[model samples]
Target: MSTVVAQTEEPEFDLVEAALALCGGDAHATITALLDELRFVRGQLALSEAGMSVGFTRGWKPRFEIEGDT
Candidate 1:
């Protein structure tokens, strides 16, 4: 008899979490920041086809260093 195996998937960077991390783990800050960033990215997507695509679903990381870092 053969046994079935399950596979595990790696976690992708969450933008909301990253924003919260940037804002010192503040939920309000994360929501506000992510909303603004999302708007800007949506605008870019609408403006041009070559602008590339972005989504909150997954596959992203912090582009800048968090605050209070040396």
Candidate 2:
């Protein structure tokens, strides 16, 4: 019997494809830079229609809402 190796799964960011498209196949400048670009791309997405429902949309709000308005 032979052993199999596992591979990593892709990120779940719906707008990731857009960021990659913006990159246009350029070599990643840096890990931080790539993340920065992605963040910018995410913000752009939030401005677009249905963007909030896409993948993961970040919103500023209080942590852990109080139930029953208590």
Candidate 3:
């Protein structure tokens, strides 16, 4: 009888560890930076959606609309 064995490979580098290293091992700073980047990306997406014509977008509505933005 033959037995099957499973092998798992680990990543060469950890992305979270790399980010912490880039932030000088400061977890708070890394989280803050990530949140800032997320906000910037969301703002850019909102702007792009706003600039698109209704006809071009096929009446698609943005999911991130803020109150008083319409």
Candidate 4:
């Protein structure tokens, strides 16, 4: 039986395709920026609607609430 050789062709990076990809990338970045803005705006809106404010001291709070060792 003859052994088959694998072809090693260089991957094509079309400039037009790459440019289109960058446009999509820009759109994705814009969406992410808008999402972050929305998160901040929605958080502010929620706080305003609830009419609640919280103050924090310059320290870290413990996340571990150990009831007992199992």
- Computed on alpha carbons, the lDDT of every model, listed in order, comes to 0.69, 0.59, 0.88, 0.61
| Candidate 3 segments exceeding 4 Å error | 1-11, 54-70
Better candidate number, 1 or 3, judged by TM-score: 3
Q: Which ten residues in a row have the lowest lDDT in candidate 3?
A: 61-70
**Residue 24, candidate 2: how far off, in angstroms?**
18
Candidate 4, residues 1-70, lDDT tens digits: the string is: 9999999999987865565465575866656666787788777766654553343423433322346797
The estimated TM-scores of all candidates read 0.44, 0.30, 0.58, 0.37
RMSD of 2: 12.3
Candidate 3 lDDT, tens digit per residue, 1-70? 9999898997698889998998999999999999998899899988988799889989986776477856
Model 4 has how many clashing residue pairs?
0
Clashes per model (N, Cα, C within 3 A): 0, 0, 0, 0
State model 4's lDDT: 0.61
Question: What CA root-mean-square deviation does each model show from the true structure?
Answer: 14.0, 12.3, 6.7, 15.0
Model 1: ten consecutive residues of lowest lDDT: 57-66
**Candidate 1 to truth, TM:** 0.44
lDDT of 4 at 43: 74
TM-score preference between candidates 1 and 2, better one:
1
TM-score-best of 2 and 4:
4
Model 2's alpha-carbon lDDT is 0.59
Could you say which candidate leads in TM-score?
Answer: 3
Error of 1 at 2 (Å): 33
